[model samples]
Target: MGQPVMVKPTFEKLIPTIGSSFRCFDRTGLNLPSRWHRHPEIELTYVDRGTGTRLVGDNIDSYRDHDLVLIGSDLPHTWQSDQYLGRKYDRHSAIVIQFHPDFLGEQFFELPEFEAISMMLTSARRGLWFPAEVGEQIGAVMTRMTIEPPVLRLIHLLEVLSELSSCPSAEPLSSQGFAPSLTSASETRTEKVCHYISQHFRNPNLSHEELASHACMNPSAFSRFFKQSTGKTLTEYLNELRIGLACRLLMDSDMSILDVSLEAGFANVSYFNRRFRESRGMTPREYRRRYTEATETSNT
Candidate 1:
């Protein structure tokens, strides 16, 4: 699991209360805002084509074509398109289904037939992902469910849900410990701070004063506000951003450890090694070697 980040998600209702039944959307290569957000409805999504980062309540990972995910209500999520932040023609189109937990009324869970689905929904509180084989088996039915005639569509949906409830290849994405809430003014401000850091962490000029200026607060006040909101000092957060980048480099590239350290904004190799060990419990070299070996084995 990726390190859990409990930031507030942008709050909004996914579907307008028009029809009594749930809604399905078949969008083809349309650009959607990747800003983090949440709603009260549970969501099931299948990406037929795309490549990008998907942030689902701390389960940060890259997503490619055929990615299928089911997120419980109020869990924050957004998929950033690798094509371009706003470009629609390159990649990313999906079949999405969204509904309130009580779309069939609260009494639906009382049925004996729905017992397994009830447990599955409960497990989705942490977010669930069906495997590729499950996706292949069910993806077509899901896409068609959105546009099929009402009565038949509902039956297909039930069938899909039953399949999901028992699919052995399923797994949870985000950690159970990640319980985020609605967005607030304070949270919005911190999000801006985080955005600023993510964009400029490599700059040597990045400091508490620089960050405070972006936040429109004086140095001392911003320090306290940031610590309170994120539970980490600005310095620690900066290091986290740098370390995360370093980890990505270690996994994907052939850069030397010293070069990776400098590229990740550390002044020297020794300090980077110390911090890497403290955060990762191993030196950068070992991390790269182990990760590479594991990846090679998996691919073979």
Candidate 2:
């Protein structure tokens, strides 16, 4: 074989007007994909209604009635709804604004006046929730931006970012893995495999054969497709999945190392310890000890 082909990450981009540096979209009623994707624009989104899973990076959780979130450049995320197929909720709506950091100029953010805004963008890499108290104010500004002229909208955008940066309490969402890496579109064979792995990650015996069968592909074909699409071997992806859950357990529960390893899909403690160390740079016990100490320090 003449060298295996290498695939790069998929990037979705925003299209701005010929002279404009930003784009805005407001949807009164819509259904967004649960598929994970990333683009290189800083995004600010306000969800007026809808409920279901909200994924940012590797953080998996539920979102409800109304949410105002800011996602940094290229941080993967999605708002998977609970709606029936092809159905749209009357009250389900959203406003999204996407822009590049250098929209004004390459050095705009380096100016003294733009320091706070730059910092806010940096913090948003971990994702952000514009604390409820200040959300309405920011949402109102975001709305005004959609109808304003490009010049005025830029001003409104600055006003919104400034307010968010100075809020008495700025809250960060998502975990340390802020880069968008995992993804699958709904009903695709890749999606089927993702669903399968998610449900069966607690079993250490997961193999390429079983995954291929579940996705209706032969082993060789599945391996080729998976690597080409995701740019990672199946085993590497599964190991990351297990380690992610293992981190949660280490932080939130009192489970022993062996138990946590088993629950996260390691067949035995030795393998778990080795993989955990490879991923986290620390053994399970040390990881747990550091996390607990940090929690205790914060509480006290």
lDDT of 1 at 299: 100
**TM-score, each model?**
0.69, 0.59
Pairs of colliding residues, candidate 1: none
Q: For model 2, which pairs clash?
A: none
Point out where model 2 deviates above 4 Å. Answer: 1-10, 84-91, 177-300
Model 2: per-residue Cα lDDT over 172-224, one tens digit each: 77666433333433224555565456556667888889888776789998888
- Prediction 1 global C-alpha lDDT: 0.73
Candidate 2 residue 269 C-alpha distance from true site, Å: 27
Instruction: Say which candidate scores most in TM-score.
Output: 1
For candidate 1, the TM-score is 0.69
Worst 10 residues of 2 by lDDT: 1-10
